[model samples]
Target: MSFTIYLRCFNGIVLREALRFVHQKERFFSALVRPLVWLGIFAAGFRSVLGVSIIPPYETYIPYEVYIAPGLIAMIQLFNGMQSSLSMVYDREMGSMKTMLVSPIPRWFLLISKLLAGVFVSILQVYAFLVIASLWDIIPPISGYITILPALIISGLMLGSLGMFLSSAIKQLENFAGVMNFVIFPMFFASSALYPLWKIEETSEWLYYVCFYNPFTYAVESIRFSLYSQINIEYSIGIVIFTFIFLFLSILGYDPGRGNLQKKGGK
Candidate 1:
């Protein structure tokens, strides 16, 4: 009976999330469009202007479009993860999150359920982008399709937890836009998403070190490795570490008594 109830709770959370998404179809469409613009318009325009150098994953010269796919994938997940966090903040302000917190289920379970729901939504958007990429002859290996799922889920969890952590820390929606600008763009550009660390190394060794240290860089590299059906041991380890650290911080942030969320300035 206990097991059955647990399953029911999980299913209930999943169902509620799916229904919420269905009701807000425009948001889904808008999320999908953002990445499409980056890939179809931005990448296309800049592919030629940006010259490529030998990078680890690439044995030969590859198109800039092909090179940036993994980064773009990471970008999509980053935006969605942050968006999920933003929605949580909105829900809290609207009182829905407060209701969720009062449920009988463990707080961790509630958090995981929300994380899983965000993962499901982000993965759907990713696959949609992949299908479109295929039409443009930008598909990765057929085997990559299988490996990509787990990588995507890991990246999703990391980003979603980041969202949760940030949501807990920031009191107002107005402040979030500032974070999006100051945090997200720098995180994306400074990583291997736009250029190889080695290339960045030639320009500035410190910037390369920064890229090496950025958790998002590992996530992008993990996605890139999976795209070729090749394993990157460092990326695999980095992602696991990154996910756990972010998750731990998120749990800490969500703790009602000790977390920043309950602070006067946050409200």
Candidate 2:
């Protein structure tokens, strides 16, 4: 494709998703509320449980809210990524996705543009959450905020691609919502989002291993390390590998004559 045409198509997809985001103000608030509830309520309960101890990402004793902040940020991206996929499924059902799919633009380019739009919105929501967290005096270093961007971008892409792969298999809106319960909650809970892996290990060895291996764990860990103005090379590498693999699977899942959505559309 010509450079101009590619840019045109990319911008169109991104602009549409941006407009959709703006129109749905509730999504922003909803994303904020879920994490804030955890920070305010769940963390309050856990605060006494963990009892002002040192954590890996913190040099000194920190509040539970501070400790869980990165996990909550990951939670925001997780939900937003699923929201993007839900929108994709809606678009497919409405025939708009099919229209885009049949366009002369490369499928990979279309998919990448769509995922970028989703990641863009996710990053915005996460930063907004950070601002709110700061208001509650759960502030990280100013530089940590800046340093966390790359982590957030990589994490968003990983989650968004997983969502896209999911949308491809979900033929209807009801089915998509139902299926997300199996994926999203398990991912958030089974990861370090709520509790440390060692904590889980103290309870169930298998569950600890599950959390250790979860891609979402690395997502949370990357953000956790970044929020401390450091980096987790293992988490960063895991996210890179997961993003590429999921992106490839999502592309295959969206293919005509072979994938689930196309098969349902054929029916």
Cα miss at 254, model 1 (Å)? 1.1
The clash number for model 1 is: 0
* lDDT value, residue 64 of candidate 2: 75
Model 2, residue 58: C-alpha shift (Å): 1.2
Question: RMSD, each candidate, Å?
Answer: 1.7, 1.4
Which residue pairs show collisions in model 2?
none
After superposition on all CA atoms, how large is the RMSD of candidate 2?
Answer: 1.4
lDDT of 2 by residue, 1-267 (tens): 689999999999999989988999998899889999999899988888775456677899777788789999999998988889998888887878888898988898999999999999999999889888887788888899899999999999999999999988786788876866799889998998877777788899999999998999999999999987998788899999999999999999987757776478532
On a 0 to 100 scale, what is the lDDT of residue 110 in model 2? 97
Q: Choose the strongest candidate by TM-score.
A: 2
> What's the lDDT for candidate 1?
0.85
lDDT of candidate model 2 versus the reference? 0.88
Cα distance off (Å), candidate 2, residue 175: 1.4
Per-model TM-score versus the true fold: 0.94, 0.96
Residue lDDT tens for model 1, 1-267: 387776788888878878887899997888778777877888889888888876766777888888888998888899888988898888888878888888888787888888888888889888988988876578787998988988999988888888888888887878889879977898899899987787888999888899999988988999998888888998888888888888888888888779876784444
